[model samples]
Target: MERVPLSEVVSDCVRRWFQDSLKEAKAGDVAMQVLVGQMYHSGYGVARSEQKGRAWFEKASRYRSSVWKVSNKRPGLNASDSDSDEVKENIK
Candidate 1:
């Protein structure tokens, strides 16, 4: 899939989405953390900071790990798992 350019992202909406998803009642969703990481990484809907990006990416990894440990779980339908090392090397 083609990625949406960082410059065009709606920062406010992304912020709102992340905040709302963090609420206790809405905490069931796991993708929010990943989206937050992506926003930080690309500065699409947030300020650009590699430290922040890494932090969020770590959070995403943790979320994925948790799911994997539960009920034989894996990435969900909308989850954006990273490509394999082989695929990444090929693209370089």
Candidate 2:
């Protein structure tokens, strides 16, 4: 999948989608957290902040570790469970 450049993702709806994903990330959705990290890293729909991106990525990694303890499988960072095409696109 081709990535949508951050400069090209200026739509309000896209921004809202990222905001919603961030909310889900805060709620312990590991995949969403990674997506949020990607967004932050690239400044796709938010201010670019490598520190915040790394933080989110670390959070997601911790969550994945917890999940692995229970399921014996890591929650891999893939777009399989994404609800938005934009997420799928950006996550790749």
Candidate 3:
């Protein structure tokens, strides 16, 4: 799971950020889900888990779709216009 590098150590701040983002993600925040996904995929803080990352991404996609279906407006993505593609970029 050495996605970043063997020598690169995760900082405490990054770990805290991951924890906070994970909490928000669990609370139904799509943005947080993507962020947490990125963190997991990159091993920025928590242990690397591409499977967990993809799971979070799928959750975000499903949630976003439901939100759009209900309101006729997609959730505004801050990083990019496309959520799936943007979220996918990090994993690859």
Against the true structure, whose lDDT is highest?
A: 2
Encode model 2's per-residue lDDT on 1-92: one tens digit a residue: 99997766656766887889989999988878877777777776788787887787778767454321222122233443333544677889
What clash pairs does model 1 have?
A: none
Which residue segments of model 2 deviate by more than 4 Å? 1-10, 65-92
Report model 3's TM-score to 2 decimal places. Answer: 0.61
Q: Of the pair 1 and 3, which is ahead by TM-score?
A: 3
RMSD for each of the candidates: 9.8, 10.9, 10.1
Model 3, 70: alpha-carbon shift in Å?
Answer: 24
TM-score of model 1 vs. true structure: 0.45
How many residue pairs clash in all the candidates, one count each? 0, 0, 0
Cα lDDT of model 1 by residue, 1-92, tens digit:
98877755665666665456445213644576555555555565456666765565466566575322222122122233433433677889
TM-score winner among the candidates?
3
* Model 2 weakest 10-residue run by lDDT: 67-76
Give the per-residue Cα lDDT of candidate 1 at 59. 60
Candidate 3: where is the Cα deviation over 4 Å?
Answer: 1-10, 65-92
Estimate, for each residue in 1-92, the C-alpha lDDT of model 3 and write its tens digit. Answer: 54765344447667788899899999998878777776776676789887887787778767564322212122223223455664688999
Question: Of the pair 2 and 3, which is ahead by TM-score?
Answer: 3
